[model samples]
Target: MNRTKILYSAAAFIAFSFLAGVTLQHATAEFVPEWVKNTAKWYGEGKTSEVEFVNAIKYLIENNIIVLELDQKKTESKTSPTFENIIIPNGNSKVGNVGFYIPLNLEIEKGTTVVWINDDNIEHTVQSQDEKGNLISLFNSDLLRTGERFAHKFNDDGAYHYFCTIHPWRVGVVTVS
Candidate 1:
């Protein structure tokens, strides 16, 4: 083939590839699904007493719970409230010094920070999940021994879900408003 023809073909290919990549990068992807929005509206706004709220939390766990980040923000000991936030201790029922579980249905104000301390003897993972229990993101600590801690700041106003990658059953939720 002629050198000019070959060079033109190569240039065209490179241009097309660059444009395709740019288009994909600029595309907007939806985070939460429509059904999840409907469900959140139904329950979050629904009038229910404390008992019902607890039950609803349980129900949400039974159904939609996704794991995102894993084992993130491990602390040394149960330290003082570093910032304005809430603490959820791991349940005693957990075997081998289990870590705490945060409900995926919290109503947190924007700019609020939340921390989770692992009082268990063993290590635990902190992960975030999608509405359908899909692993969205995760972070891990080598071993969050007794008094270990993890903290995260929520800046956006939306529902964030998280779980333990080591123990998928262990889950938590953060709602920023």
Candidate 2:
């Protein structure tokens, strides 16, 4: 009830609340991708197409690579969308294809959905497997025709390896954090 005691208690409460608010506000951890600089340079030099450049920018923004502290309404900040996808290119079925799926290895945050679109002119399946070439039964997709996509939402932190049952050599990985 004394003036000094009351003042000290109020200060301590305010400090504790401030620290808690800071922690809550930073719940989403953001990181910068190392390839962004090189990609930007390539775009500036006309090596990369406009669509590719735009897609890179969207990937950065949506994935929180470029964090923008916007002081606006709550819903306004959530407008940026998440677009994570892998493309099974036309010649993906071929054995020893270096780039069977565009960016054969992907790193994403938890709760992110990754889609593998079959751009090839053949049927394929996305079957999850262990690193030792054994099926782990995590995710399995039906036969995907050309233009069909198989999507999986990763909710945990681990490396998920998948391959096409028809073409086992066609393998890719999604690492979630």
Candidate 3:
């Protein structure tokens, strides 16, 4: 592991230890081994190896003393759709179909950024439009060729309807709340 990763692990270990002390009211002395603290201190002070620090954290986690729910966070954690980038499918412009965009509608939380990539051979544009097909002026991308991309971060909460200027029928919506 790199020095930065070691430092970050040490910091998270200390923070979890502190949290365990406050939350584990029924925790016994056996739950928090003194060697773990020593290992964390030594690792943070550059006196211990990364493997030792990682082992100590593993021991605590295995014992169920510090259950980390940080990674289990929902929509907030997933900034984009399941597929990171929306693929402008092949033969998308030739015919107008319901599934023109890979994922027709993307529902995400506020402060999430969405990316659209033109994976087709022809050119395309990502522009925000209203329900009646009028331009909302929220965002507009330049004409993008194959393998080109456009990205926008949604800070406000609303349903964003976007369409390709070249192929008006190829549309997608991103609902941010």
Better model by TM-score: candidate 1 vs candidate 3? 3
Expressed as tens digits, the lDDT of each residue in 1-177 for candidate 2 is: 445434433343333335434221221212434354445446666677756655655565577644544445675767454569999889899886664788799999888889999989989899999989897789999899999999888989999999998898888989999
Which 10 consecutive positions of candidate 2 have the poorest summed lDDT?
21-30
Which scores better on TM-score, 1 or 2?
2
In terms of lDDT, the best-performing candidate is 3
Ranking by TM-score: 2, 3, 1
RMSD (Å) per prediction: 25.8, 23.0, 12.9
Which ten residues in a row are the worst by lDDT in model 1? 20-29
Please provide, for model 1 over 54-136, each residue's C-alpha lDDT reduced to its tens digit, 9 standing for 90 to 100. 44333433443322222234444444443443344646226464444533356777766677677555566666678898876
| Deviation from truth (RMSD, Å), model 1 | 25.8
Model 3 residue runs over 4 Å out of place are: 1-84, 96-99
All candidates: TM-score: 0.43, 0.54, 0.52
lDDT of predicted model 2: 0.72
Q: Give me the runs in candidate 2 sitting further than 4 Å from their true place.
A: 1-81
Model 2's number of clashes is 0
- Show model 1 residue runs off by greater than 4 Å: 1-105, 138-143
Candidate 1, residue 98: how far the Cα is off, in Å: 11
